[model samples]
Target: MAEGAFIRDVASFEGREVEIRGWVYNSRSSGRIHFLILRDGTGFMQAVAVQGQLPDRAFQAAGFAPQEAAVVARGLVRADRRAPGGYELELRDLEVLQGSPGYPLTLKEHGVEFLMDHRHLWIRSPRQHALLRVRAELIAACRDFLDSDGFTLVDAPILTPAAAEGTTTLFEIRYFDRSAYLTQSGQLYNEAAAMAFGKVYCYGPTFRAEKSKTRRHLIEFWMIEPEMAYCDLEQCLEVEERMVSAVVARVVERRRPELAVLGRDVSKLEKIRPPFPRISYDEAVEMLQRAGHSIKWGDDFGAPDESYISQQFDLPVFVLRYPAACKAFYMQPDPARPEVVLGADLLAPEGYGEIIGGGQRIHDLELLQARIREHGLNEANYGWYLDLRRYGSVPHSGFGLGIERTLAWMAGLEHIREAIPFPRLLHRIYP
Candidate 1:
């Protein structure tokens, strides 16, 4: 048996015979020459098989193997600018491990629902492969930036007794004799972790039971929430800008090939630097009103409003100091303007909205208690959370960056569903 190699590393094996084990991406035949495209998850490469060089059976296998057929091919690698990944293989032998003829997905156009129903198989396509690879790179970039910036990773519980964002979007479940809900946000727990470790982060899947079906909304999504003790809203904004810029830079540097595969405009991503444009909620509302939107000052922004605001700037824009009544109860109210809270929502450019949402949290025990009462939350369930304030609460700030939304923005995906491998949307829960 020849030495085995992955399609991604085939460039290093030029002129050397190696065995590639993967699924057949595509195949075509022209007279005596058969071209086979193979994908091994790492990347895609083309293998050319000549009828006279290989045995008749092997040539037939190469020519007849259908899409996604499991196959092992031995070939000598060569540089070919015309081929995928700028490399191709001169096939010496081909063996079909398992024939996958009559595959449901083909080169023909497919409806979104049909494609989604066959998502288990749809991910095998080159475009989906590129999306997944970019998603992985973005996730790694996020963790690397946080880990290097003195932020400790702390795990938050997936199941909790109370709502963190709001009671309206809680997924209730039975916890033995009592009831529990899937966590909407880990911010409340991260607050406690920040108090202990000074700077901490929690990265995991969070659930929101929203009923509306929008291209930007996912019922289950991943989030990276970072909390910093003794950090105010301004400091938090600084960290947000730096982290966002760093993550985008890393993706641009390392995942260029994947981004190219997705047809993303790298020049747009290259412009994501520090000191993003910041405007207050009042200014945003004024701009929206001037632009003929029917939004008022105290009302929260909808998808259309956010899209309009984001489109006004080239970089991610921060809309700060939203009305306290529209934001979460934990947000610290601005001292000078009691009606608005010291919170910020970082909206992504080109119509992707609110990738990051966070701000300085209320640290005073009395004020927190009052907010809890005002929100009509059960105080008994939050006694442990209240203990953090009673012990040693300091002014702190943090934010949650939705991984799917951020990846969608970075990858230039039209729907947020493609950012995740197996998306859980309002009505989607299959393969």
Candidate 2:
């Protein structure tokens, strides 16, 4: 290894010899010139190997290096307008550590199932790389928004005594002799944290055991739940719009290349500013019915339903005030309309579907207790949760923005599975 230069730091070594360790992503050559494309995870760069200029060992290694083979390129960095990442490696020497034989993935079209089955290897592709980068930026931007806004980070348990959303879609676990379940949402714990810290958020993995095969559903996924004490429904919506806009701005500014790689229309993201359009559930239902759907008053929105409503707006639209019976047990019912809860679901534009669901929480102990019992959940299990209302309850509000769903919408990806590095679906879980 010469001079120990990483591909990302090659600009500093311009006109000077340096070493690059990476895997061969691609290769092409005429009889006289060989172009070797390499990626070191941080970035991709091209290394040129010409005939008669290299020693037999170096020339032979570069000429026949298979895709995915491990190699080290000793070269001088040079600026290239046409090369990837705006730089090229002039190979003076080449070393192949290990050769990959008959790599399965080639430059051909593969079905989604086949690609997903080979996802462990398919991540090497440019689109997959871009998706991963956008996902990272989304997470970073979310944490930045919350942390800079004076929101404390609180860790939520993966295992819980009772489900946050409901028990129907919970994955129950046998904990020694007692029964526990994987957390469906971090909302409840974020609530308790908000009461203690004034404002708090939880960013972690959440599980949903529903047997959904929709493009937007994932059995295991990540969520960013921001809960604020003394915040009303309107303030919560403001926080949501701000957080989402910031995250989208980060992706658009820092990840333009990644977005281009995914073929995302930058204009759509450029329109993602604050003061997003808001409509009521009644309006959404009317819109859905007008769109030729037979949706009733109390029914929730489905994928097609959300798609129709979202297509009406260019920015992420918030549909507020769902029927109390259709919402979670802890959602606060609107004082003016006892039948509808003061909740909201942010549906992304262009049929990306609902990426956020949240609302003001019920702070009254008796009301929460009645809701719990009405929902047929065990009261004894919610004693600790009830204690929050009993001890010092404030009108707190929060919302969870699904990381993968949001990433899919931001990157203009077709499937939500591509948003995460290693996706866990209802039936598929492997390498």
Best by TM-score: 1
Instruction: For each candidate in the order shown, give its overall lDDT on alpha carbons.
Output: 0.92, 0.90
**Candidate 1: tens digits of C-alpha lDDT, residues 1-431:** 67999887887888899999998988889969999889888888899999888888999888889888999999888898988678898888999989757899997899999999999999998889889988898899999999999999999999998898665588999999999999989999999999899999999999989896999989999999999999999999999999999999999999998899899999999999989999999999999999999998889898899999999989999999999999888999999999999999999999898899999999999999999999998888789889989999899999999999999999999999899999998888997
State the displacement of the C-alpha of residue 224, model 1, in Å, after optimal TM-score superposition.
Answer: 0.3
**Tens digits of per-residue lDDT for model 2, 1-431:** 46977877888888888888889999988867889899888778999888776777788788899988999888878898878777898888999999777888887899888899899999998889888998899899999989999999998999988778674588899988999999888899998898899999999999988899988889999999999999999999999999999889988999998898889999999989999999999999998888899899999888889998889999999999999988999999999999999999999999887999999999999999999999998898888899999898889999999999999899887788898888999898876
Model 1 stretches astray by more than 4 angstroms: none
Best by lDDT: 1
Clashes of each: 0, 0
